[model samples]
Target: MARTLHLGAFLHGVGHHSAAWRHPESAAERLGDIAFFEESARVAEKGLLDAVFFADGHSVNRTYTAGTTWFLEPITALSAMARATSHIGLVTTVSSSFWTPFHAARMLASLDHISGGRAGANIVTSMFDAEARNHGFDALPAHAERYARAAEFVEALTALWDSWGEDALLVDR
Candidate 1:
């Protein structure tokens, strides 16, 4: 028998398309509703999805090249989704350009602990001008510079994650 592939919902506001708001099922009006996101994650869990993925960026893409839609901070949203559903993996993005390795390491570790080791971080180095401006930088960090920092950031996170041995959490006092 052929193996069946597992599916994970890469959720975006209401839906993937920027114009999904015009559709009847799209809940564009409830962008800030935690219940809306929780319910959607539950529905996906009910479908036995392998995971739910949330995209992250430092700043909103407000250029309007595509229709405007709400974008929530990924790590925070994914942490909430973790509480809403069990067994479905939670993946979120963090930009290397805007955050330090220590910050990423601590948060990801907390998420992993909270979610029972099911947390995954989608590391990125933001390159958009708007994002740079948001971080008080005059220009977007150069691609090579961003990548170099990202490499170090990931390395530091990995080291921090490994620094704690599997048995480090033993409570045998």
Candidate 2:
């Protein structure tokens, strides 16, 4: 028997389509509202989905459609979703181009622990000039350069994660 692949919904600012917010099916008004996300997770849970993934951006860009503009931080939003659902995994985007290794590791690990191993961090190399400016850089790095930095970033993150081995947590009284 072959194993089936788990389905994860990559939800963003109302829906997947760029113009989804303008559609009747979208809840554009609640893009930044915690309750909106909470309810959406609930719906996903009801469908027995494996996870809800949020694609993130570091900077605010021009919005041709009606929806959020780099608002409602992913980690914080996932933490809130963690409180609302139990079984569904909460996946958040973490930029290797911007965040330090230690911060990424700690934040993801903390979210994982909070949600009982149901947290996942989607690694990304920021490719937008706006994102670069947001991080105080004059411009976005070239693809190869970004990947080189990303390699180091991942290595550092793994080291940080390994710093806390499986048995490192001692809650014994």
Candidate 3:
């Protein structure tokens, strides 16, 4: 089998460098604009990249002075990216801790439809007590608990997504 390297771009404001926003040519003013995001996706598509990825979190965790709290909500932004590109995949990080399995599955499934089957989700068992606190927990769940919940959540998601096959509407059952 021939080995192939898959490449994807992580879209952040201007760049990923900590000081990117400080650079004069970084176009820092366009941070939340969807056009900026679309352009990034379009470029990736032109470059024949496999996908464009967005990382998301439940809580704001950044130093105020440096201003790293720049994230457009992933699902919504990816929807826009879907419209702007034809072939490149749209992938987003979904924190399992923040969403019920059914809800997350529905959202991601819809994205797959919207993207013409190019949607992908990176389900994450989120870390950090601060992230947990925002979701009404005092502290991060125990390590085992986190993974356990994530495992169960994934099982539920798979079941939900797989519930209706192409022949699901047949009366042969």
Candidate 1 regions with alpha-carbon error over 4 angstroms: 1-4, 64-70, 169-173
lDDT digits (tens) for residues 37-85 of candidate 2: 8888888988989999888887767754345554688888888898999
Query: By descending TM-score, how would the candidates be arranged?
Result: 3, 2, 1
Global CA lDDT computed for model 2: 0.84
Question: Of the pair 2 and 3, which is ahead by lDDT?
Answer: 3
Could you tell which candidate, 1 or 3, scores higher by TM-score? Answer: 3
Model 3 TM-score relative to the real fold: 0.91
Worst 10 residues of 1 by lDDT: 62-71
State candidate 1's TM-score.
Answer: 0.88
The full ranking of all candidates by lDDT, starting with the best, is 3, 2, 1
Error of 3 at 104 (Å): 0.5
Candidates' C-alpha lDDT: 0.80, 0.84, 0.86
Clashing pairs in 3: none
Writing each residue's lDDT as its tens digit, candidate 1 over 1-173 gives 99999798887766767677778876877876777888888998999988888776666786632453446776777778888988788888888999888898999888887888778878989757887898899878788999999998899989987897888777888
Which residue pairs overlap in candidate 2's backbone? none
TM-score of each: 0.88, 0.90, 0.91
lDDT, candidate 3, residue 69?
A: 47
